[model samples]
Target: MIPIALAPASPPERSAWRRHRFLLLRRSSQLAVLALFLLGPWAGLWWVKGNLASSLSFGVLPLTDPFVLAQSLAAQHWAEATALIGAALVLAFYGLLVGRAYCGWVCPVNAVTDAAGWLRRRFKLNAGSAPPRGLRYALLAAVLLAAAITGLPVWESVNPVTLTQRALIFGGSVAWAAVVAVFLFDLAVAPRGWCGHVCPMGAAYSLIGSKPLLRVSAAHRSRCNDCGDCYAVCPEPQILVAPLKGKAGSGPLIQARECSACGRCVDVCSTEVFQFTHRFDHRRD
Candidate 1:
């Protein structure tokens, strides 16, 4: 077991940029996407309009949240052709990449939860028991069920991801409070409670991108020092067990649907035990 004291440390031999390259790239991706949304409202640039729920890019490209589309369909709300196109685009994008990549690279709430995680490690705070991982799938089902029964897309009203994006681009509301609540919950109550165990949208994405080309491989598992830094930083550490420990006939590819493909494992491993690769790359050392 990696002591909590050593959990946050990355491979020190690598240059600082090498150690944190993927992390920095993810942050840049998240912030850059957010800035595009903010440009129209804050600076009147009008590059991307609407919110993450649905948006028009350059008034030509359409992008919609497929989960929201599902909810709308469940509610018997007829969607426009553009909405359909948008949803298809999103589905196709995530179909090629890992689904929860949205959580790691695009969701604004990710920034909030990530900050909470960093603080937890910095303070060595013990995370209490988290809710079952299966709970999110139930919540996903319930969200659709509520949409069907109540004739409303109920989750959207309270979804932290959309709320955070809306609040950041459009000024202020309960988004800050909602985002803060998620941060606090992850920090004090559960280590990775929200995105890892409770977000319905994440559940929806996991299903959509259940099989993706992109994956993190434990190709060099033989070099692992058992320092636990990869487990310490992974958003879905449970997926690492089989690949990292290397059971007979088990491939090095992390094939789990829940993996966010966040690359924190790759970033923190002292021995370069993990790397981003296609799902087919199972070569083990």
Candidate 2:
């Protein structure tokens, strides 16, 4: 267990809880969202009527993945008014609250990749000659172009995120195989690589929620010990470098779209260097 920022006067149990607090909360959120989808089919409770890609809660609150919507639009597929509203709601939620948050909190594939990251850490492994970070953008462009060319939502037809969920619900062998391949790729080839480096959907989220209001700020940058633990734990380590220690423009609020706003940095920093703050609260000095 990493020793996060803890009050010296706090008791041991409290300290332990504090260290793992955000991580536990995140896991709970992830599982709860998954349960919501499962509840409809498993227990005959139609509270939500779809998977993460698209869902309507209580038969009213519609939510749709805007990236999927974008692909559909590119492929010249026209969605109804309700689906448009759902996409707008999703965009507003992610834009107002957190960017790329889906990657960290709601994506089921996140658990798979997180497990891979844990295994990599346990084995003391290092990524070797990984593809350029910009490959994701290229892939994003390629997917869009493919959609335009083929007049079909190509990625949606076979997206692992959706496939994994469908597999869990319907037991599709091909979907499970696709998911397992992703897990193995993350575990053996790259550490924190899929969402961090590739994933066109993540790129889309980052753009949609580019200047999200909820952000993880380096509020206590003065106390930083250069321990490198934050970098070690952060899925998007490059996003932290400028805010933590670099040129002045980026400020304490991590402005990069790639930031998932995952609290690992805050949870691991024993010196209390990192703290969550709004996008406007750039107290850099």
Candidate 3:
């Protein structure tokens, strides 16, 4: 067995790292808000003005642009098909290496919610709890089915990034305004509300997250005091907390399909209760 060691550091060093992590989270939240409120809308407007396909041009990630791939796949054009497949493989590889860090650190909607929740705390509004984990899968199925049948990328309509971009560029249409309002309310009132309960991309990640490779682990359970700080701070609390509390089964490392592996739990845990591990090790736990 590979031996594990504590992250070599004094308490002061560890504390400094914690502060840095929190700062990163806060800065990420700020950038997300800016992107959603400013750049996203501009991109959307450009797409609309040019009559360009949103996915093909204005999507959050270039790899996620479904229109080109969908068209290629639908047409069964070998050259386009090969290119699309290659791109997909690259994205999958990148995701495995990062472990959904994008969802926690970079997703615009998630940032909006984080900012909203920060504001709501002053009003004593509690962060809303996540809905049933199964809901995401159902939503994913519905979205894919609709996209397949209608040949319209339905994800664009509800996507927070796209909505934000549209709102920024169009100067607030009714639809864009609603999207912004919902995002603000959900972020402020609910932790990862958009991602935890609604994001179809999250559903896709959850399905494949449990591969035997590229997992996180809790290296020193004995250090745990059960203070629950990690649980309290976890953005994807349902996934991280319930399992550690022994209230849920361990299959998917985190139960919520929405977990973005942002390392918030690791940052908050006073006991150093968690770390990245392989799936084989995660199952053994």
Global Cα RMSD, each model: 5.2, 5.1, 8.0
Q: 18, model 1: CA deviation in Å?
A: 1.1
Estimate candidate 2's alpha-carbon lDDT, on a 0 to 1 scale: 0.84
TM-score of each: 0.94, 0.91, 0.65
Give candidate 3's whole-model lDDT: 0.55
- Per-residue alpha-carbon lDDT of model 1 for 228-256, expressed as tens digits? 99888888889999998977767899999
What would the per-residue lDDT of candidate 2 be over residues 197-237, giving only the tens digit for each residue? Answer: 88899888888888898899887786777879898888889
Residue 218, model 3: Cα distance from true site in angstroms: 2.2
lDDT to native, each model = 0.89, 0.84, 0.55
Runs in model 3 with CA error above 4 Å?
Answer: 1-16, 22-62, 65-79, 120-123, 127-130, 165-179, 187-191, 241-258, 277-285
Index of the highest-lDDT prediction: 1
- The true-versus-predicted C-alpha distance at residue 71 of model 3, in Å, is 10
